[model samples]
Target: MVVMMSPFKGQTGFKRILNATGYSLAGLRAAFTGEAAFRQLLLINLVLVPLAFFLDVSRVERALMVAVCVLALIVELLNSAVEAAIDRISLELHPLSKNAKDMGSAAQFTALCLIGLVWAIILLG
Candidate 1:
């Protein structure tokens, strides 16, 4: 069997980590600036996440709460990536493009629903 390594894996030590960090920051900036949904979620998280720490949750519960919220942001980033890729491919209407975008949105929605359910169950149940 043959194994494939990431092109990024060639660089070792602190410089590689720095480059990866820079790439991540750039991606985050792009998502925040270019995607309205991403921006909205970040703002909402800014308020909700810190508030989560002050809740009466146990350590595990608090971690779970914050994790789900962060998952929503991750899903949104993926959705934005899908939309951007589709737009890059073409600006015209196409069924496949719509499907790709909608599926991305559906994934994000599912993640968000999970976040809501976690908070509700842990806090209210």
Candidate 2:
């Protein structure tokens, strides 16, 4: 007879949540240590989070603003990861590496523009 063991057998819901939260915090720390753009976005979030509360925005507008900020940060994090991996594979300059880095930078630029557009629409419309 084979006994099946649950992966989360000993963990309560709250404990699992806390564990996941801690892991996320660690990831953010790693990103900040390794990525300059992540640090900039984090600083932006620090300012925007307080501004969101004071703007007297509607629930939907506030949610949209927060979502866009988070999305931009996420994209920047991915771009940084890609650049790091490319650098790890080869320290020498390569066309593909240049292309990858350029594309990643473009992606971050696009995300920033989207955040601005969303905020403008929400605030003006």
Candidate 3:
């Protein structure tokens, strides 16, 4: 048997850490520049995270509120990645591709709902 590996996966140790960090930053930049939904979520995070600090909530509540906002960004990133990958595979319409993209959108929708629920509970309850 033979194993195949990506040439880009060969880095190890400190060099790998540096390369991974660069790649991660690039991914973030790409999302921020290319994905409208990501930019919108980021704007929301800019508002909500700082607002979390000014609220009179306990530390744990503040953390929870900030966390949900961050979670939405993370979900949006994953959703964007999924859509990009699917588009890369094929731009032509296919049922499976549509399903995959739809599932990713649904995941982001759920994350957004979670943010609303968490913020509402913390601010009102």
1-92, model 1: which lDDT tens digit per residue? 99999976898899889999999999999998888999999987898799899999999999999999899999999899999999999999
Which sections of candidate 1 miss by over 4 Å? 1-10
lDDT of 1 at 119: 93
lDDT of candidate 3 over 61-117, digit per residue (tens): 999999999999999999999999999999999999999999999999999999999
Ranking, TM-score, top scorer first = 3, 1, 2
Superposed Cα deviation of residue 14, candidate 3 (Å)? 0.6
Q: lDDT per prediction?
A: 0.93, 0.88, 0.95
Residue 42, candidate 1: C-alpha displacement in angstroms: 0.7
**Model 3 TM-score, all chains together:** 0.95
Error of 2 at 53 (Å): 1.9
Using TM-score as the measure, the top candidate is 3
Q: Residue 1 of candidate 3: its Cα lDDT? A: 88
Q: Could you tell which candidate, 2 or 3, scores higher by lDDT?
A: 3
The model with the greater TM-score, 2 or 3, is: 3
